[model samples]
Target chain A: MGYKSKLSWADVTPKAAYLNRRQIMAGAAGLGLGTIAGPVAAEVPLDREPNTLEQITSYNNYYEFGVQKEDPARYAHRLTTDPWSVVIDGMVDKPGTYDLADLLDGMDIEERIYRFRCVEAWSMVIPWNGFELAQLLTKVGVQPSAKYVAFETALRPDEMPGLRSPVLDWPYVEGLRLDEAMHPLTMIATGIYGESLLGQNGAPLRLVVPWKYGFKSIKSIERITLTDEEPPTSWNKANRREYGFYSNVNPNVDHPRWSQASERVIGAGFFAPRIDTLMFNGYADEVAGLYTGMDLAKFY
Target chain B: MALKDTINGWARKLPTWPVYALGALPPFWYLYLGFTGGLGVEPISELEHRLGLLGLQFLIAGLTITPLRNWTGVNLIRFRRAIGLLAFYYISMHLLAWLVLDIRDPARIWADILKRPYITIGMLGFLTLVPLAATSNKASIRKLGARWRQVHWLVYAAVPLGAVHFVMLRKGWQFEPLIYLGIVLGLLAVRLLRKATRMRPHRA
Candidate 1:
């Protein structure tokens, strides 16, 4: 109920917090974002509220429990998200073990409805509510030496039934170039659909790199290591040909096994099997700037 | 008598080469279509459906060879190899479609297999073929000797699994799966008939 200054467009504009999400959804009305239509544009909160959004809840990446898609949703319920701590170290100016509460304190969370594309060429539209990674790194004062920001998930082979497999280096790590980390599209998600994230959906915290394949957004972290060299992620070490460190989305570069030109939108069901993949998952306007003059086919 | 012997010579070789090529065509076509994107408009689901159907077709083809050899003087005994290979090939593609396209995530791929009974059984069916394909070679067959048949007995297990993979993938007892189940049952019945007749003989 406080009077605010003139923040243009979505900021101080008269609309409710569905905010940029409705804008994206409206644009999605035309594109193949799957059965969603955005509400009318407004300077104020629109009368038509955002649809009851959903998260792309998934099985935990732990393979030991059995690599079933539904297993994580069932087993992840046992994971403890409370009293979490992330050790930030390496090239950062400020390195410390910060509690979850302190790290997330006073942060603004926004809902970004994006098409979650898997390397296997399946996808979903998830309404993720998170603060940008740039916001958090700024608090810790990211150093000039920090060229890449890497995240590590907690690994306990004993408890996490999935971690029992050596298929991936447990305590999975994912990284982003400094520019990619600060990109508005890069998020440290804590919630979805305006509700707190479920345990299966990387509760407590997880990264959301919209342009990169889903694996790059590592989940269930224990640490953040900002490094000068590109970090060795679990997937890259596992298969050099299939997974690469810079896994930018490019339709031209077909994943040796499958083509990336399209993706099956999971919830879309039998009648409608898939949706056409977009450039940077349809966040082209926001993220296209980062890649500038670079040829995507070569980098991809 | 000279003409009869000449015709018999050509007839014996006929079933081996051409029928083998025919059975192989389906899987080769599937691979070509998939890689080239000919499976079309509904690529993922369509490819999945076609791959599963092709697997069932090859299963039927392997089964049909017996009938062909039995009914026609053109015994297609050698073509059985190609039929079995194609069966394995189609099933392999089916697994790939599910693993890469259907599930998508490393996390979810494993989850789909472990969590879903249909997928788990289908995965088992697909994996069971690996040893069979490896043993299909004369080297392994000779190496394994008497145990080759026992190891290949896993095909019996694979047959049911392939059916189950199809049944559950489609969900419900639809006509397509039911038709496949019917063919598989008929094929198994023929094999059982031959086994029973063998066991019953010696009175003559």
Candidate 2:
């Protein structure tokens, strides 16, 4: 495999409607069992791996909008992503604000079906369309002194009600070590499910570090700063005991509140077995070498 | 007064079946929604949360029967068994949803119950309901007699503990869970006021 693998566009399409029709037909044949038994009968018929677009789009935790899992889908329509521009500053030689159009001028968007694990112990397999973040960083010409890459989301208080309360420090920020930032797996995604990303799913542009927790993928990025000092991340700043900067997916290192050993696969049925969480979210083959000598438990 | 009379009339004639059937509606609705994918993404989580909330609501509703009778002379005592049984069913399903769907691993399930304060409280509340559910039958009521009345008082502890579990489960200060806590406290307050009045010496 190369830096990223591309899945066919047709592969991501959801069969929700078709599945529902089959269930309805089955329920009609079993009318003697009554409506009570209809739903249980429906769930037993099919087995499909990919999450439906509805599942990917509706279930999100963009704390900018609200904390409820469904809040982003309900409220993110108000966010304005059209006239978006990302400021690339700090130690980079080409430090300037570039519009989304200029940023994507010559970039090739590849379809990546990645396993997205949330620190909350849930996961989704998403088909994301984007290019390697290292490509963009290279174009900007990183200075020798830069050792970390800091990111900031757009600060829109009126559009984002969650900002009204100090749930977290406003304008969420995250950072990656220089080598991690330059890793080939690191991507700045613009779309998902072969379509332009919905406002809730970090429209316009967002970071996607697949091996890290979902929170590290910081949404609707407005600033990209290359710095030497470690940046204060939103969650790490909120609760150091629970969240860490690295936030890598490690089953061995449990979250103080909950076990990280296993995760609920989203779109899997109620009785579907929870699978063991993989080291580095199944990307250990590609990323484990990056942290050779360091203790992951301490970092995590 | 007329509305109260009408409710009491229906409560006397039909009693258990109608109210018991009311409890069945939510699961059926949830099942239909589940099959149709009406429950938003992450249907299992949504279903679990909804079922848990339904259990708490019915438990609270069963608690309201005594207070309603004391205040308005509109007794729903006859239907209390149906409501309590429904609460038990929903709560059992809620716990199963978390065990079977959300957490999945049996080892971690024990760890979560022991370690997490919210999960501990929720499980304790579930355990408290066990004896009450076991003795919900007429046979147990006849055998235990006055002791049954004392044991069933566990609802007072179980309902509030369930509410506190909900408040603790969600992150940060959310008003929805707090509102649920407020409702439970308000019901308890009403009961306490009645108990105080009943204890005072009555003038002949």
Candidate 3:
């Protein structure tokens, strides 16, 4: 089955070579490949050019791997993604560890291109290949009492060096209100650039909440618990003042140190004009109802 | 003795224009990298960081001149102005990079300078540099006389403030920025210790 929509962009990442970062990096490290091939152009129409494969894969803030932007790509290759299992429990009918492949055995995967905004005021538009989280939750049979969906990233200290350092509480956690979790736009991404997700970009499994700050979309998920209680998030736990529970993309709400009114799009050339950040990062029409009558400034 | 004097004389005779030319290289290299798509993924941010560090390095170099002569007797005072002016040039570029590239909106730029502590200190450093840079020429030095030296002492304040600004810019226990602060503090210690020794009374 295939899914199609009017929401399209002039720039689509060329499918073939973007996924092979590990191969290229390995080749560079004396595996005998001389050239790192660039992403070839494709005919997918879009408004603006997507960040290059290098930009998308390399420049990321996966604190689990490390703080520096290049740290993830440099370090995440050690992570073991094959035969991954996700432990699902708390207010679910089917409460057990499910193999990643078995869980998504019958689900249809579609490429949903959405704007990803980081709390640090950098932005990117990524084409994510995954099914809606709503479908997954439906598959698991959600109990009526479940109000929030809590996620826990895999805590492999040896594989993830940053985990050894006291960056935050271990097994980095993130949560979403059940409605937000069940939203059509909210996805459990398995891939990008039309290929399987790279280890650095949260391979095997990761949450993708396009409307929220990039940190809210937790990576390398090992557990997803459907619970009635509000779960403690990693960033909010680390510094509650800076990172709030509801990390919605609202330009009006300025981060304590940096203004969120505008963002410098990564890979946009040297003098490229900074674009004004939109309400809910241009997904307000779809997600604003989720936060109706609530003060985003306070919640943020 | 003759060779040492000849080398020193040659160094003294060297044109100051070369210092300015050499001083321009780092930014020029960064500019070339920017135009050539070689500044990695985020060029503007990279350029902003590199330019700031270059300014700080030059500031440290300028501050070293007095101590260098005092401790080593190398006597490189003639190049101090060129070095200081170069520091100001890089500092100005650092400020402009933040202004025009990083934060494109002018209103937001003013707001950031006013609101954020790091930005405020950084702006203060830049403000102090402006007067020093303006009066760097031979004409202003002659016109102002001793008052010029007093005014240029703003460098003492500006350099440390810039270090503080840098330290505060980073998040959570960054050692690199703190190391920079350490270098500034170390230089200040040398200046302070020398001042204390000069003030001590000597017996016949």
Q: Stretches of candidate 3 above 4 Å error?
A: A1-46, A163-171, B1-17, B65-78, B137-146, B171-173, B189-204
- For every candidate, C-alpha RMSD to the true structure in Å: 15.5, 5.8, 7.4
What is the per-residue lDDT of model 3 for residues A1-300, given as tens digits with 9 covering 90 to 100?
A: 112222453346355654443234333323221232111111222244455576788788887788777889999999999879999999999999999888898787877777789988888778778888999999999999999999999988789988766657788899999999998889999988677998888988899998899989999899999999999998898778888999999889987777888787676666555677878887787888999999888899
CA lDDT, candidate 1, residue A10: 32
Tens digits of per-residue lDDT for model 2, A1-300: 443433344554464652343334334434533432222222211112345566788899998898889889999998999999999999999999999999888788888777789998888777788988999999999999999999999999889877876678888999999999999889999997668888899988899998899999999999999999999999898889788999998999988777787776666544445567789887787899989999999999
What TM-score against the true fold does each predicted structure earn? Answer: 0.56, 0.83, 0.83
Q: What C-alpha lDDT values do all the predictions have?
A: 0.66, 0.82, 0.81
* Model 2's TM-score against the true structure: 0.83
The candidate that wins on TM-score is 2
At residue B56, give the lDDT of candidate 1.
71
Candidate 1, residues B1-204: lDDT per residue as tens digits?
565456557756665556556755765676566444355323456667777777777777767776655645445556567778877877777677766555445654664557667778877887888898888888998999999989987877788778867766541134457678777877788788888887887755
Question: Which candidate leads the pack in DockQ?
Answer: 2
Among all windows of 10 consecutive residues in model 1 chain A, the one with the lowest summed lDDT is A1-10
lDDT of 3 at A188: 90
Q: Go through the candidates in order and give each one's DockQ.
A: 0.04, 0.29, 0.25
Tell me the lDDT of model 3 at A229: 92
Tens digits of per-residue lDDT for model 2, B38-135: 77556677888999999999998988898899879898898888989999999998898777656655667888899888889999999999999999
Counted clashes in each candidate structure: 18, 0, 5
Off by over 4 Å in 2: A3-50, A164-166, B1-14, B67-74, B100-105, B189-204
